[model samples]
Target: MPEALLLVLMAVLGAAVILVLGLVAFRAAGDRSALAPPMPAAYRDDATGAWRRGTLRFVDDRLALKGSGGLAAGPWMRGNLDLGIARPLAAAEAATLGRSNLIQVPATYGTSTFELALDEQHYTALRAWVEAVPPGWNSQVA
Candidate 1:
């Protein structure tokens, strides 16, 4: 019985170590994401026209929306999994909905026009990213 107890203790310790290492690696990967940090926001669904809570991420030159809650609330969790909407920076245009900080992105083919409510700071960051100057400006000059 003592030997069995020792084995279980060892197994638990090994699992804890693995979990810590995995969390560290995941955090490092999340730090590598480009643009702004993940922003907590809700998006209007295309089919149902209902809002779903999620975190918005900009990585690898694309913007992705991942569902919120659960492990995603942790800092180590990048919230990159189960992306709902992933589109290139230039694919969609963002505009203010009204006096509020709400932003509306008109949908393109096969997509629906949706709105994302953001605070002032995040709204500015997202707007700047969407309306940034195009690359290869000098090359365009003949």
Candidate 2:
């Protein structure tokens, strides 16, 4: 009976250790959604010129941005730039612009993505610029 009791205790202890380790691993992964702050409504105006705004719901791993008329289906117009980033926004020019919109740059320690909002004209201009550059030209973290 004593031997059986000892075995049970050891098993319980092992399980406890496993649970602790799992929790630690989860914490290390650093879920972004949980850390995201409430987005400001001031950035959601449609009258703003060439301004891009969106909420990076880190919890959902999604970036939502607004264009002119505060909708994505609006007619293409100049001074509009709407885009999304799947991977973390590079700290380069794109990232710099993101900061102007109050976007928090993701840490380089893990995989991250970003989303963008722009007017149609601005989007076209940005696309053209990206295409004009050599492949792999913007690989550096922005």
Candidate 3:
């Protein structure tokens, strides 16, 4: 009985050591991503004009959108498209007389338009990316 108990204890100890090492490696990977440049575009909108944070990454000429993340900052949705595939639009929906429109992307599911809440810096960055994207398939739904 004592010998069996010793074996079990050894197994548990080994598992714990492996878990700790994996966690350390995961943290290191996260740090490496931090070294990369910030996303070229991030925009948000709220009724009151308060800044809303969202992930709009441009890497290797691809766009990545991460909505509100989970507890560990995992993106709720992850999608990327070549810069050539994105079609810039003045407005996704018909503009009303006083409508304040925010940036909109025509995602696979349909047009996803953000609310009007992005700060000045983020808004400018978004415009730069949109204007730079080369014309592609007419994805911008009329």
User: Considering every candidate listed, which one attains the maximal TM-score?
Assistant: 1
Ranking by TM-score: 1, 3, 2
Write down the lDDT of every candidate, Cα atoms only.
0.52, 0.39, 0.43
Report clashes for each candidate as comma-separated counts: 0, 23, 4
Candidate 3 lDDT by residue in tens digits, 1-142: 9999999999999999999999999956754554234442333332233333445544434444444551122221222221123333244231321223444332221233333223345556644664565556356758
> What number of backbone clashes does candidate 1 have, counting pairs of residues 3 or more apart or in separate chains?
0
- What C-alpha lDDT, on a 0 to 100 scale, does residue 2 get in candidate 1? 100
- TM-score of model 2 (CA atoms): 0.26
Better of 1 and 2 by lDDT: 1
TM-score, prediction 3: 0.38
Query: Per-residue lDDT for 48-136 in model 1, tens only?
Result: 45556667776654556666543232121122222224432221222322233444343332232445545556655655655453565
Best by lDDT: 1
Residue 23 alpha-carbon offset, candidate 1, angstroms:
2.4
Compute the lDDT for candidate 3.
Answer: 0.43
Kindly list the per-residue Cα lDDT of model 2 for residues 6-73, writing each as its tens digit: 99999999999999999988855643333244232112233222335442222232323333464532
Worst lDDT 10-window in candidate 1: 73-82
Residue 83, candidate 3: C-alpha displacement in angstroms: 13
Task: Mark the regions of model 2 whose C-alpha exceeds 4 Å error after superposition.
Answer: 32-60, 63-142
